[model samples]
Target: MLQPLPQEQTIMAETDRISQLPADIVDNILGFLPIEDAAKTVVLSTNWGGIWPNLTQLCFAPHFFRRLKNRYSTKHAAFYVITKILLQHQGPTIRKFEVDYYDSKTETVKSRSYDIDQWLLLVTRKGVEEIKLHLGSQEYRLPDCVLSCRTLKSLDLDSLLVRPLRSTYMLPNVASLRFRSINLDFFSDLVLDVPSLENLSCEECYEMFHLHIIAKSICSLNIRYCSGRELDSFIPVNMDLRSIRTLHLDSHSLQNFVDDCSRTGLPLRSPALNVEDLNLSDFCFKEETQASPLIRLLHICPNLIKLHISLWCPVTWRCDSTYDDEKDIPSVAEVDRRLPELRSVAQRHKRLVTLKLILFKGFWCEMLFIKELLAALPSLQEVIIGHSNDMDSKRKCEVMERVLHFPRASTEANVTCI
Candidate 1:
């Protein structure tokens, strides 16, 4: 067998040397560079170019490096340059397209171009995988073809808003989805079945953030600032997400959560999946009592270990002429549901280890929130309280003493307060 000649060896070294790097090692290094920079390697030689097309993961975002270059140079062609690279890439192995378009410019005027649609079509047709689209603009939906694509894995639509968009598309394969500042008012008949999904996020849901999840594989999620008085339209009981792990919930009204709770198979009762972390925010300004969903989380997330909660222990009361038989003094719900819940893993229950309570106004007192939590979570190693506010000198000592002392309520258990 004759070995390759000198010229052949030299040419092969330039083009095929990259193949020598372990596959995972190559991906790790390429992962750090923007997709365009990663693609630029191809120009180095055929070997490096081939590495990009075979990349199982891709991230294309503007690194803030230019921000460090000069104090004033950053406010220029950064976004347009990102768009340019996305359109130029013609690879099929892309698993993630993270387009973080935050305006670094003070007064940058950008004109709309149809190039976004063209590039989107190219990726979809070639079986590009995950897409994380984050824009700082009020543009709500991407082109129909991009959203309607069938091969997406995870999508994060952040800082999105209402714009000129029409009714179209059904996502069949996208799991792990997110929508931020989105107006889905035009989405009347949207349906989805993303069984492979692991997370779903929605923010600023003033208008209906309409969509459905047929997947039970979700692990981390966030639904915040959703003023949709009725959540049945956004998330029905039929959307059984039993696999949730990390969850952040903020709804417009109590009705939103209750409407969901009333749904058949929608009591947050999913198959035995470990839901470990939960953050409940976006409290309703007016509520008769704590919503049912929160009460249900204690019962549902049997494996929850970390918790972050923000609630409105209303400083004011409603003058419902009929219900106000008693003089209206400030009132918060005496909800028993949370008292036991804070105890579920010791309220932190199920090996609950960390707790962060922010804006812990009335709800904690309603359920003896702090007392029950200190009682239930014996496994707690760290606790952050009054996080939203800093403790003054006197208050700091008082707060620390209470926290450290509570763990010893039974027989002087050991708990360090820092």
Candidate 2:
């Protein structure tokens, strides 16, 4: 039926054949093997010789480093060789690249500085979409050309110092940033123009950071530091609050911010953070004060869906070992009346779904406060009550009952006793 295959078609099919296998069969068969081994398949015949370097997402982590370390006596020279190999490959672009840098025992910051800039520049020139730079003690500054990176999206700096710049350094498209230790005293401050930014985290930076929130698409934020609040400074109550869905605050810098907000009456600076998963820890109190200075924390985030509290008093608040049974125990109703405005405030926020109570040290006086709290959260679904096992069984059971019975609608909700 086919009158005989054309001569050009026959010649094309024969040349497409590699060794003895047909073109389709060899290509399909080669896809199953590792790239290195697949390249070795070329030795079986004269048809295939080079194929491994064209992969889109090139990986150079564990295996590459091991081979380099065994071949070369110096680790620095090994890093250079690896850097050259990655730079040589062309045509097929890298979509994502991850450099898991682990320095040897004797390596120091000065040893790795020069080549790091070269490697960063190479990846930048290749148009890397997402980059992760994780380093240990050998801390290095960011490269000069990082601002020019056009396609970079998310960046995470763990235990790295961002070199202070005189001019406003703009990461025009970076969406998410997470860092552990950074010196931000001379760093540039600008409107972070990431239109798609969703998450941001900074931990253990002591300097006061001044940043205007310009990202209209932000959703989650986590900041842990001890700056930005002076007794005289007016910090507003989340002025730009509509876009945020969650926030976690762990700043021990101030004794009490909401009370400070109340005393100053600063709308621009209110301690109230509107979030779906709000967590606050007040670890800035001295145990020896005569009066209760930490009581006002209950009203801080009135609408938080989840709350975790841990309070510690200095040695002065610690009671003597001797018994004082004659002293009266405070009534739950009396403590409840002090928080009249807080419960009403919580009722307005629709996101309070869960509550967690973390009490570092507590005794008789604070228990009544805890019982009243169980009765306060109207829509609470579950509760986690944690206390050091400083008490015996009888007191623990009584404490457990207060938390378990309060959530009216949660018939099957869990109450963890820790």
Candidate 3:
């Protein structure tokens, strides 16, 4: 029984409704948007400037800034605006801070290291929970303030120097860590004192004399080789995990670890045996390739429920002096013809349910291996075959049809080709 308000007054009321949203709610809404877009909300109303500062997540990736007409000028402008935002931000609590500052050839990393350190220092003071820092070059090292940040719960470092400052440096609360393209040759023991850490991923790291992953709560691990030739000189890496659920090991890394343990007379058993999901990638096979290393690894992982394998086939060119022609090169087939023998290796796994075959190159040897696997595993529930996108559809269909006809021990087993 109230009279309708005037049109302008109704509009004003609607606008006020949005402006009156709780500060935390407004901050959360802004947190989902890129910092640049969040800052643009300042133009919506006078109150938005204060609301933008309350945002808890700050991400400064390449697309967070406006694209300038001159591509070369964007880096400098981005750096300037980023510095200004850090200086102006008054947020007392930050949950996440991610910075992926990739610059073109014109701007050198040496010039931006100080600004990056300053920005990191500002975020560290705000009690940042998760931090991901990816720089353009290896020369830029992360500031000590970041490494020593006790409040951090997650960290992903790429292309940075991560040498420890002292004997007992600690990340008390960190639960997840990832290192990509990092140099760890200087540290004798890369001790992970984070008892809360559950996930660890290390890839493309410099050859370390010793890597001591001492996280007691770790449940998932992934390690891939950076360089294949350096495996011979690698030190025996030790892991003290409680009960890992998932483990992924590339061909070179698995081979190196196994060889190191064999040479040092150290027990090859660990928490990795409890792994239920296993992924093996970058695995190459030749006539001379030894299958004992991979077979032994599978033997230890008796509880594996899922298995993934990606085969690597290398191209070898043999020049003939008699032909005197560079174009007349013979094609080399690398997938081992004896790969069918792997069925014996996998027969012990009575619990295996899912098998994923990735990057299959339509080789007859590979098809034989698949046939053997289908016939050997009685409990197999499903088989996923992943192939290259560029493969001919007709050829792929033919391959799938052939695999569908393979003798399966389980009648309920289904084959999926992707």
Candidate 4:
């Protein structure tokens, strides 16, 4: 038999190259493309056709529908495309499923709510492990199937309304959960029955009167910008966080958490003994207030090894105050009056090894606070001071000099300014 010519051989090799690749590699390559584009690959070759149906991850983004021709309405086109893909998917278990639906008109989303529910039902049956639904401004009610999915390991939701569960729903395998800009008004007391959950985050969510988290295995919890209906009222979070090792809270959430502890008198009974890392942002230290929440957290997390605090400074300084005066350090009498509680808390936190202060303005109050901290924490090994962008070189130098000269309780402590 005569072999093919060199030129002919090259053509055959190029044609067979893609088909010869492993099925997992082909699936990964198709996974990067949008669901519509990945589905269209079926027409490329017989091998490609067989490969796309087994893709484990499917993402139906906004561009998936926007690229279609104007034969059908946007909502209709989206519904048709998603249904076709889910129906044709032959994978044993879809690992991840994401839908980012957005329309300028809110009525469009409302009209297609049923279709969205159907898509979720199909995916849930296929054993999807992760689901991310980012429905734009409109409030779409989540289907009951999603909440009860046993195979789900992660859930992320945004701009949706969560209704109260009729029966006790437990996500046995879910480990990570996140909510952004969600409305929980109808849910008077939201109970998270995730036994295996390890990480939980809530950002900019509102109208949650009470949150009852039953995640005994949770290790990290983050709450930022969450609030209640009334201006002064705050959402109370109730959980047995004895297993938690990391805690992050902004000013709003911290105040709410502190208030909840005070109202229930739980702080005195149970402190966060396992927490090793604590991050607090936008914390205000007023001169008149005798008790400080920052100090309260230090007391709660007694075993903390790392602490990050971002001081919240007022937009406008007092008219009588001078910003450039380096010698304007507060007297010892005044410093004691302002930060009386902090001194006691600092002395008790001997295990704290790292201290980071963000938005350091070298103000009199801030300097005094730093001085007290340096003199108290005997195990502190590193101190990082972050200054504002508008601070001049001269001002930064002045602040650094003062921080270095302040008496240190830990001989190994090194202070750096940036």
Best by lDDT: 4
List the pairs of residues colliding in candidate 4: none
Q: Return the number of clashes found in candidate 3.
A: 0
lDDT (Cα, tens digit) per residue for candidate 3, span 78-191: 677778877877778888888776654524556777888898898889999999887757778777898789999999998877667665558889889888887766556546
User: For candidate 1, lDDT tens digit of each residue in 1-418?
Assistant: 9999999999988887666777567766877787667766646654455565566555656464354224556444554554565555555556656666566442332333344455566667767677666666654337666666788766777665433243434466766677776766645455456666677776775556355446666777676666554555555323545667787776443345445554544556432446688777644322434444455556556687787766454445321121123334243333344345435535335466777766533222422456566676656666666522433456556554555555422332344433
Output the number of the TM-score-best candidate.
3
Task: Order the candidates by lDDT, highest first.
Answer: 4, 3, 1, 2
Candidate 2 residue spans exceeding 4 A from truth: 1-85, 88-92, 99-107, 137-139, 164-166, 188-192, 210-213, 226-239, 251-274, 282-303, 308-350, 358-369, 386-413
Model 3: CA > 4 A from native:
1-22, 41-49, 65-74, 104-107, 228-238, 260-272, 285-290, 315-341
lDDT of 4 by residue, 1-418 (tens): 9999999999998987987778788777877788877778756767676777788889878777666525564567777777787888787878789988776667766777888898889889989999999887545888889988999999998887778566457899999988888875655555668889898888888765555556777888888888776633343344566777988888767766666556655563225547888888886564333126666667787888998988766757532233235345554355556565777778777789999999877665677778888998888999998987656788778777878898988999989888
Model 3, C-alpha of 58: deviation from truth (Å): 0.5
Q: Which pairs clash in the backbone of model 3?
A: none
lDDT of 4: 0.75
Clash count (model 4, backbone only):
0
Error of 4 at 7 (Å): 18
In lDDT terms, how accurate is model 3? 0.70
Instruction: Tell me how far candidate 4 lies from the true structure as C-alpha RMSD in angstroms.
Output: 4.8
